[model samples]
Target: MKQNIHPQNHEVIFYDVNSGYKFLTHSTKTSSETMEWEDGKLYPVIKVEVSSDTHPFYTGRQKFNEKGGRVEQFKKRYNM
Candidate 1:
């Protein structure tokens, strides 16, 4: 493996916007925003739109849009 070819991983905080959930993890992603974590230390915060806390699959609130197949959609679109 080539040296210095990989990005550096740092302890970062991911904040879920929808559920207001926050978690600490290591990632190569960095951010300019900072937030005080539960450990009483500041860490870079990366805001995310969705996380396991609010994700439909994880929350068991997934909605199935089983409106048939492509043919059914086409028919519905044409009012057939």
Candidate 2:
């Protein structure tokens, strides 16, 4: 660990575009866009397409391909 060798880590806001969720955390990433947080402090804002709030796997919305009819074929093959 040397001085001035690492980038600055600052608190930034990550906005989820799909879920409309915003959270503040420390990141080295810099953004030109800034937003006023709940604490009345201005911080860099980064927009993300997906987040845990709206991700399919996290929300348990991942669906098997029903159009393939694979489950039906397997059940029929096994007489189940």
Candidate 3:
């Protein structure tokens, strides 16, 4: 509702470093790096450490540590 109060949004590429995945989306962020997209146009590329491509929760690769509760640990320690 204000004039020139919001940041500019433009097409940018988000690159997942872990999974080597790249996707184009709109964001207010800018980068010095640039990459050519599938549509044959160059866009500002932003590198991200985590994304849906390799995230543990999204990919269903999460690990659960079942070390047991306090009582179970006590029993195991005392051999009871």
Candidate 4:
């Protein structure tokens, strides 16, 4: 570990834009924006577009394309 040459290690907040979910994590990244978390301390808030809270896969809302009814076509083609 070098002395004073390294960037500061600080707590960061990742905010999910879609779900308004936030969590604390440590990073070397810096930001001007901050938030007071449940621990009663201010941390850098970084906003993200997606998180598991609102993600389709995690929410069980994920959709799959029918591929133009390919399943039926495949069964018919195979006569199975």
Candidate 5:
């Protein structure tokens, strides 16, 4: 093990905006906003747009469009 060679792993909060989910983890990322946890210590808070908590795949809310409808309409108009 090398001394002072690895980046600091500090406490951080990953906030999912869509689901309003919060998770505490350690990472080397930096954030300008700070949050005081239950332990009364200030940690960096990072807001993310998407995470497993709100992702369509994990939540079983994924949306998809049917291409057959559009293709039929286009073929009828263009005679293709």
Candidate 6:
């Protein structure tokens, strides 16, 4: 493997915008913004609009219009 070719990964904090949730993870991305973590150390903070905490699929809150489903539409059109 080539040395010094990969971006350095650092401890980062991801803040979910919708849910106000924060988590610690390692990433190659960086930001000028920093925040003090629970350990009292400042880490680069990344703001995200969505994460597992706020995603509809992960939260089990995703809704589909049953009346607009393909199966329902096919059945209605075919008189099934």
Judged by whole-model lDDT over C-alpha atoms, candidate 3 comes out at 0.88
lDDT, candidate 1, 1-80, per-residue tens: 78999999989999987667999999999999999999999999999977898778888995433568889989999999
Off by over 4 Å in 1: 62-80
Number of clashing pairs, model 4? 0
Instruction: Give each model a TM-score.
Output: 0.74, 0.69, 0.74, 0.59, 0.63, 0.73
Using lDDT as the yardstick, the better of models 4 and 6 is: 6
Instruction: Select the stronger candidate by TM-score from 2 and 3.
Output: 3
TM-score pick, better of 2 and 6: 6
Evaluated at residue 49, the lDDT of candidate 4 is: 70
Q: Tens digit of lDDT per residue, candidate 5, span 1-80? A: 77999898878988876566878899899799987777888889999868887678888985333336878969977999
Residue 8 displacement in candidate 5 (angstroms):
0.8
Pull out the clashing pairs in model 3: none
RMSD (Å) of each candidate, 1 decimal: 8.9, 11.8, 11.3, 12.5, 10.5, 11.2
Candidate 6, after superposition: displacement of residue 50 in Å? 0.2
Give the clashing pairs for model 4: none
Q: All models: lDDT?
A: 0.88, 0.84, 0.88, 0.80, 0.80, 0.86
Please state the error at residue 27 of candidate 1 in Å. Answer: 0.4
Please give the distance, in angstroms, between residue 35's alpha carbon in candidate 1 and its true position after superposition. 0.3
Predicted candidate 2 versus true structure: per-residue lDDT over 1-80, tens digit per residue: 67899889989999987667999999999699999999999999999877777678888894333333779878878899
Residue 31 in model 4: shift from native, Å?
1.1
Better of 2 and 5 by TM-score: 2
